[model samples]
Target: MSEESGSLNTTAAVGEKINAISDGSQIISAGRAISALVSEYVQESYCYRWLTKEPDPDVIVIDLRETYAFGPFITLLDQLVPHIEDAWQHSRVGAAAERVFKRLVEDVFAPLSETRGYELAAAMLAPPEPPERRNATVDDSESTEDELS
Candidate 1:
């Protein structure tokens, strides 16, 4: 076996061992799911791999409240993630991701109080939607401009 493959096998074996030794054997969520969310679905407009793979819709819900993942996730939301409106319309998982994006604006980036952050937050929190609902489009097109004013 190649070094990386062998290492990953060793790691999985170690994880299995640890779980077996613990009081209750429970599978922990891995960063691979998060990575898939980032790489395949969130960042790739044409992809729905994240949604298809997460058996439970809630599996994909990112807790924006997580302080550790907050910075990196916010950076991705602010810079790289393209809002896939069609996916939002289709998948509940896609719709649920809105909370993370909204919190990115209202809580973290909004504190910075930059013009861009304010604009993004306004766009995110637009139309006085209730806490359960948020606008899913992050398109910077004129349609968004119309909604802003």
Candidate 2:
């Protein structure tokens, strides 16, 4: 098979794995999942170059955030957060999972934050804000303006 087809096959496999994890059909720990995702998906994408580039961190983060790969990874990370704790509690996989997660945080994310800035790393690692909270803030401001008038 051609290289492109192989890549596509790999991508599809990764996607299935991610979906399985999301649906709880697969019992892999978050760290393993994350490692697979980064190596198999993110590293092969356009963002990898910018992620490893020596230029400004914020610029790299910003550029990467706009790419197609960024959002899904962010979403996946958010989903994986709960699993990390659960995996850590299991004896069989706990130690290994923790080690992998820690390395991803330290080796991958920490360096990104240290070299680039916190924005991209934070965006990748942070849980997304709920829509209701955002809407409430906007509504509060609107109400305050009415009271002032």
Candidate 3:
């Protein structure tokens, strides 16, 4: 098979089934198929440590059970975004999947940083803070002594 065909097969072979709760919400229940795909295609990816939350469209939660596939294939997301948007626009579940896709790309699939944790911390703190201003006036001018004087 051509490389393109192979990739298509790899993606198609992977599968997931999401269960929607009665409150019109969904969560992943089984992920072995997805895990197998990650093991096959995602180098250096590891099992998700916890359940991760998507920051938008608060209708669903991603079960980290299947996100380990992001370790290497995240670069594809730029291309995948169009597909994700198309899929999501068609279904709420797909919308949730798009968020999951983004999280995986951000947390695992992106290249490892050479900078140390301290470097990141320093960068965050590097921004200059606004200088503190002195408060000029107080309302304590009502002393009886001033009146007597």
Per-residue lDDT tens digits for candidate 3, residues 81-148, read 89978876899897798899998878865643444775687688896654432221222343545777
- Best model per TM-score: 2
- List the pairs of residues colliding in candidate 1: none
Largest lDDT belongs to which candidate?
2
**Runs with alpha carbons beyond 4 Å of true place in candidate 2:** 1-112
Predicted candidate 1: what Cα RMSD to the true structure? 25.3
- lDDT tens per residue, model 2, 1-149: 69999999999999999887677744456667888887888777888877887877665336554569787788788799889877668766887877899989988877777765577666788988899999999999999999999
Candidate 1 structure lDDT? 0.69
Instruction: Give per-model TM-scores.
Output: 0.19, 0.25, 0.18
| Cα-based lDDT at residue 118, candidate 2 | 79
Worst 10 residues of 2 by lDDT: 57-66
**Residue-level lDDT for 110 in candidate 1:** 70
Candidate 3: deviation at residue 32, Å?
61
Q: Model 2, clash count?
A: 1
Off by over 4 Å in 3: 1-100, 106-126, 133-149
**CA shift of 1, model 1, Å:** 89
